[model samples]
Target: MRCEAAPSATSPPAEPAAVFTQFVVKLYSRCNFGCPDCYVYEHRDRGWAAQPLVMSPAVMRRLSGRIAEHLRSHRPERAQVILHGGEPLLAGPPVLERFARRLRADCQGLTTRVDLLVQTNASRLDRAFLETFRRYGITVGVSLDGTAESHDRRRPDRAGRGTHAEVARALTLLRAPRYRPLYGGLLCVVDLEADPVETYEALLAHEPPAVDLLLPHATWHFPPPRPPDGGEAPYGRWLAALFDRWFDAPRRETALRLFDSLLDLYLGGTSTSEMWGPYGSDVVVIQPSGLIEYNDVLKTVSAEAARSALHIGAHNFDRAAADPGFAAERAGLAGLCAQCRSCPVVDICGGGLRAHRHSPDNGFDNPSCYCADLSFLIGHVRERLTHGVSMLRARFVQGRWSA
Candidate 1:
């Protein structure tokens, strides 16, 4: 199951290997529900419009073998493999079942702990599909942007119909005791208009294991909606309201990514330390064609830029990891922010998510689009910090410290 190509004799002695921690595999390049804000088609550099709808069997087989080999060699403590795509569910049950079966068999040696997850829209959930997911212990995170009005505004179908009803109904079914464990939680994009309190309550009713709020994909060119100059905070205000409500909650398990990041930063840790930071661990994305890319969101930055000449069948994980071009892309991220070099919190924030720094002129050599938002949130947290230790203790005890 393991293969380690000998390091070339001419090359200097190998440095310690960076452990491979997480990987995203694209099962298909097609989706059933075409959300307006989707990065794959709406904003991507590479076109998925003409690509194969599903991953070929050959690629899947090779992928399984390679991953198994990696597991055996690296003995990664916990390897997370997410089934991602334009719409991963587009590949029917039979296909996914075979893929998962092969993956299990391939990862034979080394007690390699694995975390399997699927991010889906929930519109395609069915008994058979549910069975496959449950069987593999796949944690399903459904994309539903809060209330119907809020969700329908941007997450509409190609025909412009609202998908909220289908998504809500699906959640209701998934939350039933028989399938509740499979209901991972809801993932919503921050829609400025929706009342954060209402959105929080509505999603909380389903009682998911967590909730994730994401800033809509945007850049200076196609900036996400913001309040006009001199107007009140747009995304900041909305998130602030949610933070208040969450802080006031009596009991909660619905984790919020933003709140968690802010909390970590406030507690003298890097925000997004678990996910987006530089020391935040490495993530590799595999497209259906077996092309390896970084921060899949970069797919939206340009069509041609997304096509890396890498394939799972032709390349081993070690070779791909040693790719000079790939290493350069990773290195280029740190230099993107002159501000980060001088900022004390760069280690924690990683200049915001890598994809967010992308721009036409400098590539991924810019700060986050949400820089202002982060500043606002950090200021709020710092103000609270300056108060007496007694006040901080009181707030924590009162549960009024949620991000």
Candidate 2:
């Protein structure tokens, strides 16, 4: 996963073996509710429509075998399997149990530690599913946008009704002391229109151990929305506001991945997530029909970009990683465009998300459309860290003098 450069695109060279630490497996291809913001269904990816509603028994066994082979060969320090979907709960508890059992049965002897999780919208979350997850040692993560009003505006049922109440009801169950052990945290997409402070406070109501704040998926071809004021670096300003609230807190209320990673990278430490930093990508995706693909976020560019011809039945994980696009994705600094590579804060933004760099003219060889936003956000964060560190040093000196 940590490679300095990619194999040549046209001629290519033999690639060293890669150890994939994270795998996103699609359990279901369709959702009971319609969330217009979904990257899979609402985006350019119409391929999901043709996939089986639930992964077939054959595909499950085959995919598990491939993963077992990977674990045995690579023996990575840790491995993660994220059960994903149009709505993974739609696959039902029975199917999920079997899937988990199959994975455990196949890789029982492997030395690698495995973390099993499910990311769902929580409309179908209940005790029945919770029991199965708890029994199998699977943690759960729910997608809940800010509060009821903002959440409903972006994510709603097919009938155009709000889902915050229903989702919150499920969260109440997941938050029980017994179930809190399985709480994986909340995933909230950034809402520019909503007051940043208000949105952060609203999400705090859930008492989640962690919070994943993501910029809505966008590319140069389709830039993300800006506020009514049309301010420069709007997303950066929004994130900075959120960062101040989280950073200035008396105690660490929750783990915010975006800010946490930024702070770490600024202080000369490695980031934990592939979404940030120039670290090589060690993540892969298994589509509903057994397609072994690259970044699913690339579906925002084009469905085909996220997909490949490799299948679990025909190709092993190694073969899948050998794909040119796969290598290009994990290319680190070499993956960046001339523009991004020249930027002063390129390391801070890491050229932004690869999907955000996509364009028809140059393919994946462009700076993120959020370039200005990233520069602004990262610069602001660096300033705050510098100021905070200086004050800490001064406080220590003052304490010593008093003593």
Candidate with the greatest lDDT versus the true structure: 2
The TM-score of candidate 1 is 0.87
Query: How well does candidate 2 score on lDDT at residue 77?
Result: 81
Q: After superposition, how far is residue 34 of candidate 1 from its true place, in Å?
A: 2.4
Clashing pairs in 2: none
lDDT digits (tens) for residues 1-403 of candidate 2? 3355665688556556776778999999888677776788888879987888899989999999999899888798889999998799988999999999999888898999888999999999999999999888999999989989999988888898999999999999999988999999999998888888898998899999999888889988877887679589998899899999999999999999988888888878988765568866878999878988888898999868888888888998888777887888888888898987888877777888899888889888898888888888888988998899899999999999999
**Could you tell me the TM-score of candidate 2?**
0.94
Clashing pairs in 1: 43-300, 44-300, 45-302, 45-303, 46-303, 270-348
Model 1: per-residue Cα lDDT at residue 328 = 43
Instruction: Residues 1-403, candidate 1: write the lDDT tens digits.
Output: 1235776879777665654557788898877776777878778564676667888888899888887787777887789778878778878888888888888777756588877788888788777888898888787889888888888886887788989888888888888787888877788888777888988887787778888888877775567777566254467667777887886578775788777777776676664333335453356778787777665666656676545677887887767666654554456335447876566656545566556667788776677787667656555655544664678788887886564
Weakest 10 consecutive residues, lDDT, candidate 1? Answer: 272-281
Give me the runs in candidate 2 sitting further than 4 Å from their true place. Answer: 1-16
